[model samples]
Target: MEIYVTIKGKVEPDKMAEFNGLFDLMVAGKTGAALETYGEDTFPAAESTLEKVLDKFEAAYDSINLESYTLEQGKLTLNFMGSYALEQILPDLQVWLLACGVKDVELEGNWV
Candidate 1:
C-alpha cells in the first residue's frame, strides 16, 4: 500500500537552520544536545516531545500558523508549504512524527 503525508508550517528566516537541526537531533535521540544548542528554556525535555517541538517552533517562528500531516497508502508525503524550514527537513520530520503517535496511526482510506 502507498501512503502520503503532508505537513505545513512557517519558520523564521534567521532561525530556519536551527529549527531543522533541532528536529533532526530530536529524531536521532540527541535530545540533550538539541536542548543545549537551542536552549532548554523553550524546548524543555518532558512528556509529549512532539508538543515541545511544536511549541518551540511556534515561539521561534511566529509566522508558523499551520502544521498538518496527511497519510495515504504506503507512500508518506509531507507538505510544509508554509514553512520553508520544515520543507527542508520533511524527510526526517515525517519519521519522527510517525514515531510520536504510532498507535493512533491509520491506513489511508481506512475509516475511523
Candidate 2:
C-alpha cells in the first residue's frame, strides 16, 4: 500500500539554519561524519526535519521507499511506498521532530 505521511511542524528562526544544513547535506547524498556512528548520547547537533526522518527510514528499512515530498508553510507531506503501521513509528518521529527544534509538530498518515 501507498502511505501519505503528512508532517506539520515549524522550525524556529534560531533553528532554521541547522535544519537547512541537515536537509541540504542529506539531499546531496552526503551523510556527514557517519551520523549512525554517533552514539545515542553523542548524536550530532544538526536538527532533523522531513529529510532526516525519511533518510533514517531509508537507511534502516529497506521496505520503505520515499517517492516524493513537499514542504510548504511549515507543513511537509511525504509520499512513500510501504507496508507498515504508522502507529509503530509515530512516537519516534514525534521525538525526532521535537529534538529538531520543531514546535507544535503534528503528524498524520493516510492510505490511498
Residue-level lDDT for 32 in candidate 2: 44
| Model 1: lDDT to the true structure | 0.40
C-alpha lDDT of residue 8 in model 2:
62
Q: lDDT of candidate 2? A: 0.52
lDDT of 2 by residue, 1-112 (tens): 5456666677656545555554444444454443333212233442344345546566666323445554555554444345554445556666765765567777666666
- Candidate 2 residue spans exceeding 4 A from truth: 26-60, 63-81, 85-87
> Least accurate stretch of 10 residues (summed lDDT) in model 2?
34-43
Report how far residue 48 has shifted in candidate 2, in Å: 12
Worst 10 residues of 1 by lDDT: 103-112
* Per-prediction tally of clashes: 15, 0
Which candidate comes out best when scored by lDDT?
2
lDDT of each: 0.40, 0.52
Best by TM-score: 2
Name model 1 segments beyond 4 Å from true: 1-47, 63-70, 83-95, 101-112
Model 2's TM-score against the true structure: 0.55
